[model samples]
Target chain A: MLQCSRLSFTYEDASQPSLKEVSCRMGQGRLTVVTGPSGCGKTTLSRVINGLIPELYEGKLEGECLIGGEPTTARPIYRLSEQVGSVFQNPKTQFFTTDVRSELAFPLENTGVQPEAIQERIDQVADLFGITQLLDRDIFSLSGGEKQMIAIASSCMMDPQILVLDEPSGNLDVEAVASLARILGRLKDRGLTMVLIEHRLYYLDGLADDFLVMKDGRLTEHLTPTAMRGLDGPSRQARGLRALNLDANEDASAPASVATEKTPDLLRVRNLTYAYHHDQAPALNVDDLTLSSEDVTGIIGRNGAGKSTFASVLTGLLKPGDRSEISLNGTKQTARERVEDSYMVFQDVNYQLFSETVEGEMLLGARRTDLFREVAQKLDLERLLGRHPNTLSGGEKQRVAIAAAILSGKRLVVLDEPTSGLDLLHMNQVTGMIRYMRSLGVMVIVISHDQEFLAQTCQRFITFRQGRPVRDSRKLGNLLQAL
Target chain B: MRPISIYTRFLLVIFANALIFLTLPTPLVLAINIYFCSFQVIVGRVRKGQAWLLVCLVFALGASLAMVFPENLPGHYLLFLFVGVGRVLPLVLVAAFMMGTTKVSELVYLMRKIHAPQWLVIPVSVLFRFFPTVRHDYAQIRRAMKFRGIAVTTGDMVRHPMRTMEYIYVPLLNNATNVASDLTSAALTRGIGDPGPKTSIQRIVFTRLDALMCALGLVLMGCGAYVAMFQA
Candidate 1:
């Protein structure tokens, strides 16, 4: 079991504590979920449990954290690692190896485990995760979900008593989340105490044993799975929690065809194909498609399904094939023109935000500054104008990017996974921004694997498979099931 | 031929480093580059090895062309630039082959077997794993720069040097900072800092093929050294 008693921590340079007297006890063989809005101390608590608190990030720690009856305080991270295994949010950063086989063998190798015993453990863990085929594969070739599974498998190679997963499903799609739930369920059945820190709650409907809600660096509520499931919309919203239950067929009746037809200004494309290399097949091949400038369209696909490639091509960051055509309202536009007319907010907003201040970022490469004040006010970035882009929260940085896009006179804006790794409050904020962008007559294309964000924001859905749109529908709920 | 041992590759890399300074005969240089091209092909970098081979051929041709020109002829400096980079082309290719083919586990095991300190082994392994991620992040940063209408051209750099440098370095540094901490956390949590003898599942002993490759490298180095000392 994992236990925390009056835990509070402040970073070395931080003025305020990230975790404020947090207390919780998670039972063995049960999966306890820790969830809250951004900066709510859930991650800080996980760090405390994993012994990365005072060990790695030097902080003023005032707490008692125990994992499997062992106090985490005063112990080295490696010693605590023997009791608690940690899987971080970002799959790309956690891995220290280049191949699956080596990654699986890493933790064992570090602790002076014998080569033969390590190999045996690798085989057993791989079998447990149903990842035997992935044993010999390169880590880069695997999908986001597969990489995450390997991370879990590698962490479990030591057969630690407790497992801590921080937002493992942050980058996964609906199908991947389902697969993750199954894997976690298997781990729970094997009597491994699990702590999952996540904002996505629907997939954990029956899997989670308890839900611990934290706000303002304090544990606000602890509820059983039954009570968490029974939370109404208003109650969930007040707690800043995501929907506990996601029914794909609940509201499948709203067809977007009517709105799409009413909008006269449409961006049309013909035979649009883009290949990363000459000899290989096209990564994006949309033969014929029309997008309404008034409708917020959601592009849903698995990782490497060309959703991002399509966004790049559409935004003119990438050139299409020779026989392709893209026109706005019957007027053909070249790639250069498309570049001037569209802007894309990348998945990692850190890359897009180049300026030091929000104000400077808004006018970074703009041709006009007349809309700057209005866009800033609308996005609620007025008071944050002087603050550095690096200091702002993830959602604030995204809004700054959007504000910059709008101020630059862009009519088409693309947000690639804007709400990923974001809590319900932030996701709702993004949804509201998408609606606001649509109201301002900007065509929004959101490339996402987040079903809830898409359902709340987009009017039409385009599902891509094998580098092409296989299903274009208004019934997001129905299309989600198929995906 | 099967993949050669990483020890062979490491020996060849050191040999190539020495060869870079020595004024080897032209034919010997060409032969070495060709051997490395084939070595790369054996190691599954089919296209990269061939591309480097083609580049070396161009460099050799350009170097010969410059040799035929007068001492102070026009375009001689440009040709000389190619001559310099081209002279070490084979070494660069060898280094790439080593990085591309050698796994982190193999390298770590090799270091441990050699009785290297943990401080040296950890950083070297981390540096080896950091490059590919940096490359990926750099590609994204360039795309983001293009999307934001920041010109990523030489002309733009010359005109707005500070802004261009800011555009490139800010994101790169930010990602590096984040990845560094996250990577350390990951390494520490997995008992990478345990004060014990570290073991690895990777089998990293030299094979018969490695002996052959090392002998070849020694012979080549001897020939190059003889030429540099006597002929030059």
Candidate 2:
């Protein structure tokens, strides 16, 4: 069992405690998902439980956290590793090795596990994660979702009593989330304690036994799965929480603009094809694809099924092969030309935020400053103008990237996985920004595996398979299930 | 079913690099050094050809200018740059190959096998992971610069030198600053500091290819030494 009582934490640099007077018990053989709006102290509470607060992050701690009823303070962080396995938010951050095989062996080898036994464990864990094939794969070469799976698999290889994952599903597709949920269920059946810090709710369906709601440094609300299931749409929305259950038959796909009439295609591509190697079949070989300024188009597919590659091609990051062409407003376009005409907000927004301050970032390459205040206010970035872009939270960084794109006066904006780690409030804000952009006749293309976000924001959908668009959909449920 | 031992590969790189720099028989040493590079590219699939570009740049502009106009002031300077830079490319090629092929964990495995101290092994392993990540981050930083309109071309650098430098370094520093802690934490969680016998999944077998590469390196070095002592 994982338990914390009267837990409070104040970060070294900050005056206010991030987690205040929080108390919770995660019973053994149970899954507890702690979630809330951004900066709600869910992460802080998790860190305290995992013994990183005073142990790693220099911070004041009050009250006590016990893993398996023993004070976390009783053991060193490395000693606690035997009892609890943790996966952090950024999958890229925790990895120490260059490839998957060594990443798995790292923990085992550290604990002085026998060589043959380590290999046995690696095989067992790989089989469990359904990633035996990925053991030889390069860590840097994996997709965001693949990296997340490997992160989980690496953590689980220790076979700790408690598994604590911070937003493991954020980067995952529906299929991958289902797989994770199944794995968590199996681990729970084996009497392991599971504490998941997740933003998405739909995938946890029957797996989560309890939900802990943290709000502004306090564990304000706790609900059983039954009570959580009773939350109506408006209440959940009001609380800034995702749907407990979205109706399968709901038609949240087509945007209102699409109902009115069709708009002219602002972007068009003919015979778009790209391949990494000479011998391999093209990862992408689309004959023709078009997007109109009328609605926000969502590109939905599996994690590495070429959605991001398609975005790269569209944004002109990846140049198209010969005998292939791209055009904007009937004008033939090169990669540089396309890049000049468009902005792509990468999934990891860290790369896009270059300016020291938010205001400085907003002022970059802008034609007009009149709309700056309104955009900033709409994206909840007004309060962050004085802050360094590097110091902003993940959601704030994402918003800053979006704000940067908005300020750049680009004709087209492509957002790749913008809502992956964003909470409900920020998701709504991002969806609103996309709508605002669409209303202003700026063509927006969103590449994401977030079905619900797509259901809310996107009017048109294109599903890809083996790097080519297999079909178009106006229904997100089908897209979610199809993969 | 068997791959060459990582330690054996590292030894070959070190020995071959030593021979190249010794210049006992300059041509043979150069051939041996370049062969190791080609072996990495073709067999290990560690293809980083920018080192080749460096060689071309040094030889084409520097060496050719020196040869064509040896008496001229510009030729003298070019010759100085050529001789200074030309000798370093072979070693750089070998370093790149070592980095590209050997992972941090493999290095750690070899270090423990040789009973290296933890402090040395840990940092060395960390450094093996560091260079590749720096290269990746550098690319991202460059891409971000281009997208953000602070393109670091010669013209832009000349115009806004400080801003261009800021654009290049600040993002990289900020991005990788916290990576140290993350790496430390990851290493800790894995029980890296434990004073215990470390184990690895890699089977360190001396393959035929390994034997062949070692033999070739030793033979070339021996021939170079013989020529250096007696013939030269």
Candidate 3:
């Protein structure tokens, strides 16, 4: 259904082509998995297939792309969209409507489908995706998993024959990932063609008919199901691919297990709760929590479960309630006080980054030149010191954030979903930073949903369910049970 | 009653904006604003909540304040505030209905039905998607700043204004650009364009409700004009 011949695209103002002489052909009803390290032109290749390269982006194209045996260059995006449905990486950016029903009806209404048949199609698609209950729900109120499901279902709602998904699993939980895999299987059974551009592969291991590896802007290898299964961990590492089973990615967490035993609680919490609105129900209600100085604590929870909110309170960014008591080093602190004592590296990392350059960012609110240089070197960001923080890649930006936090002499560091959307290599870089922070006697707290990262890196685990903190007695087992 | 057409809703909102500069009576202004809010609730678009109650309270308070201090500058200012809010409420009503009840595709369909210029309507339609994305981005930026020990406050504004602006602008601008690019790609791939006969899942047609609402708005405008010229 889809074919790319010697497809090469050079973005305007860029010296080199983002996608080199690469080619891919996906048959109808077959799912192709494309894996590579970050900046390996996976997104570019998918965009090319979806006709966004030469269409939306003003890039010079070197080859022809065919959809259903017809050249895509001569067709407008709207025409191509009839056959090709594209779901982007970020779910929030793609949504134009506030509610689910409207979101699903978006494309159909755009194509001038009659209202009666529109409703009929909406029902059919919602039923097909098992999201009949979500039809009327508000889009923003949904969890990340649900939003992604909607993005995918809405993209394919008009019964498009070919669907291109870019990192659909980037923000999903393991259960969500499994459900996504199941949904893909259902679509495949429906005889719809699919191209999944993903870094998270364990979920796709069984479902994908072919695994194609694109490295350094080239299709280096293509592996079958049996070949992918027999591939070893080291070889996977060398190729910059994620582990088939996330629990086995112990490159960063396994060796760092030799750290010291648990120390006394450096932070204490009692009855920490938050309600987004006073008239609404409480979003979070944590009874008691403790943080030790000598252990790397990981906070794990499903999306929209208030784990990040709890981190905000722990790091002093969000002030605890008047009745709720929280103490850092046996002294109570307000939001501003927490701001001074602890530093949090946020999930986006773009929010905390305001400096023009890396050195400027690390030097903010401090004159610790020696400390800044030392932390920068330790985080392996010493070379990017002169580069603009905005221009750095995802992993580089994250380390820059961490290194800046350490330079400011904050003993307690909290990272919220730092390894999310990162490839295996970048994931290790972030995991490594957390370990390094712990080694320096900093009370490091990490909040994430990555099961492997939590199990392999954390000495203590705290889980949240529906905004209520659950004590994970058996580590990640409780997490799996929660799912 | 049947629902109103999105075209009528858009026209009503623009008319309401024009009515802002008119010198309508305070009570008449409040009545019209309340009517728009009530109309939205009647259509089952926006839920009647704190927002509705607050509007009612503001109208009541402004009326009483005007009564007690009709000649005083402060009282007149309060009345003007009421008028200002009254002028904006109808626009809010239209926005709420558009964002909640009408799908983006439906709006585009209505725009084309009226033969509105594509270059103009496309951005307006895309803006229905843009503002929400901007709001989401703004919240993320706030969370990220809070994480980095940077807090925006009156004290910071007073102490280091330029530095404070720098801290705020850099991330805001960067994220804004990123969000815009991502949104453009997503929108383009979804086939948001001037050409091609786009289909609609939500069939938008003129109903009696549209006629009634449009007539009511025009009648209100006429009454306000007469009251401003002769009665007030």
Candidate 4:
């Protein structure tokens, strides 16, 4: 069993503690999920459990953490690695090597394991994760979900007694999330304890044994899967939690403001095709398509399905083929013109934020002060206008980027995975923002795997397969049923 | 041929660096470039050889131009500088070959086998993993700049160097800081700080290809030394 008694931690320079009087005990082979809003200490608790708090990040600790009945803080992190394994949120930064086989062997190599033994362990773990075919491939070429699989496999090289996965599904698609759930189920079958920190709760319906709800640096509620299923829509929203069942038909989570009446075609495309290299097939190929400002289109597909490439082409971040043609409202526009009239809020919002302050960022290249204030107030950024853009939380940074896009008066806005790691409250806020953009008559395209978010905002659905738009549906029920 | 040992590749790179300024015979230079070009091809990097071939053509053209033009031509110094860079191209190719083929695991194993200090080994391993992430981060920042109409053109840079620089620098610094901490934490949690002697799953051996390359490197070094001492 893993136990924590009155666990409280404050970072070295912080006046407020991130975790306060938190206590929980998770039984072996049980999957316990911790869900909360951003900055509610789910990550801090993971850090403490993984021995990263006092060792790498200096902080005040007031807690008792026990692993198999022994204090974890008493042992060094390296020593604790034998007992506890950790998989972080970001898949791109956690890996240490370039290839799958080598990355799996890395932890073993560091601990002085024999090559033959390491290879055997690798085979066992690869078979367990059903990733034997991926062993010979390069880690860089794998999709986000595949990378996370390897990350988990590498973390399991030593077969630790417990695994701590912090938002492992943050960067995954719906299919990948299902795959991850299956993998976790297999791990749980092996009697390995797991603590899953996550925001999306639909995928873990049957897998999670218990749900730990946290708020304001405290563990507020502990519920069994049955009790968690009993939560109503309003109560869950009030607690800042995602829907227990996506099929619950929570209309309250959707936008209250309706989209404006259908306008003339806002953007038109013809014969768009792009390939990264001449010798290879095109990554994106579209014969013809037209988008109206009347609908918030949700682009859905598996990883590498050319969803991102389509978005790039629409936003003019990537140049289409020579024969391609794009026009905005009957006006022929070049790539530069498309770029000027469109804005993209990247998934990693940090890259899009450049100015020192949020107010400055909204007006970086924009001169519309009146619109800036209007956008800020709508996105609830008025109180955070003076704070540095990088200093704000993830959701705040995303809102600031959207506000900047609004201030620019762009004809189109594309938000990539806007609610991937956000709680219910923030996801609702983004739904509101998308509605506000539509109310302003700007075309909105959200590239996401979030069915809840999509159902709440998107009126049109575009499904991609192998770089082609195979299915286009206006009925959200069709897409949701297909999923 | 089997994969060559990283040690042999390292020695060949060192030899190329040492003989860069030496005025070797044409046959010797041709031999060195050919061997390295074939090595590149053998490593499945045929595309890389095309670039080196293009560089060689430029160098050949410059040398022929210098021979035909007057000794006191106004732009002769510029030609000299161009040839000077070409003279060191072989060394640059050798380094690139090493980088493209050598795996981080092999490098780490070599360091540990040689009893290198942890301070050096740890940073070198992290640095190898760091470059690709930095490249990705920079690409994202550039895309962001383009989307925001930050003027990523050369003319804009000349007019507003500070603004352009700031636009690129701020996000990069933030990403760098976050990546550094994340990498360090990942490394530590995987028992990288263990005091015990490290081991590796990579099986490294000096094969016949490595021996052949070492012999070739020695012969080139000898030819280079002879030319420097006697021909000059």
| DockQ (CA atoms), all models | 0.77, 0.53, 0.50, 0.74
Residue pairs with backbone atoms closer than 3 Å in model 2 (clashes): none
lDDT of 2 by residue, A422-443 (tens): 8989888888889877766788
Which lDDT tens digits does candidate 1 get at residues B181-230? 88898898899989988888898667776787678778877877887899
Ranking the candidates on lDDT from highest down gives 4, 1, 2, 3
Kindly report which residue pairs in candidate 1 clash with one another. none
Judged by lDDT relative to the true structure, which candidate is superior, 3 or 4?
Answer: 4
Error of 3 at B110 (Å): 3.0
* Residue A57 alpha-carbon offset, candidate 2, angstroms: 0.9
TM-scores for the candidates: 0.94, 0.89, 0.87, 0.93
Interface RMSD of each: 1.0, 2.2, 2.5, 1.1
lDDT of 1 by residue, A1-483 (tens): 778899999999999999999888999898999998888989988888888887888979986887666789867788789888999888888898899999999998899999999989988998999999999998987888898899899889889999998999987767777889999999999999999999988889989998999998999999999999888877888999988787632452223523333354689999999999999999999999999876789998877789988888888888899999999999999888888788888878888888888899989888559877777888899999999998887789888988877777677889988888888888877877777667667888998877767777787889899999999987576435657
Residue B176, candidate 2: how far off, in angstroms?
1.6
Best by lDDT: 4
Q: Sorted by TM-score, highest first, which candidate order results?
A: 1, 4, 2, 3
Docking class of 2: medium
Residue A227 CA error for candidate 2 (Å)?
A: 1.2
Q: Name the candidate that leads on DockQ.
A: 1
Give one digit per residue, the lDDT tens place, for model 3 in A363-469.
Answer: 87653466765687788887888999999887888888888777767778888777778897888777777777776677888887777667667877777889887
| CAPRI-style docking class of model 4 based on DockQ | medium
Query: How well is each residue in B1-232 modelled by candidate 2, as lDDT tens digits?
Result: 2345686677766775665445443355456556655555555464354455446454545544545766878777776776556556667666766776776776777888888988898888777777867888887776666666676355877898888877778777887776787777666665666676667776766777777777877776677777767864
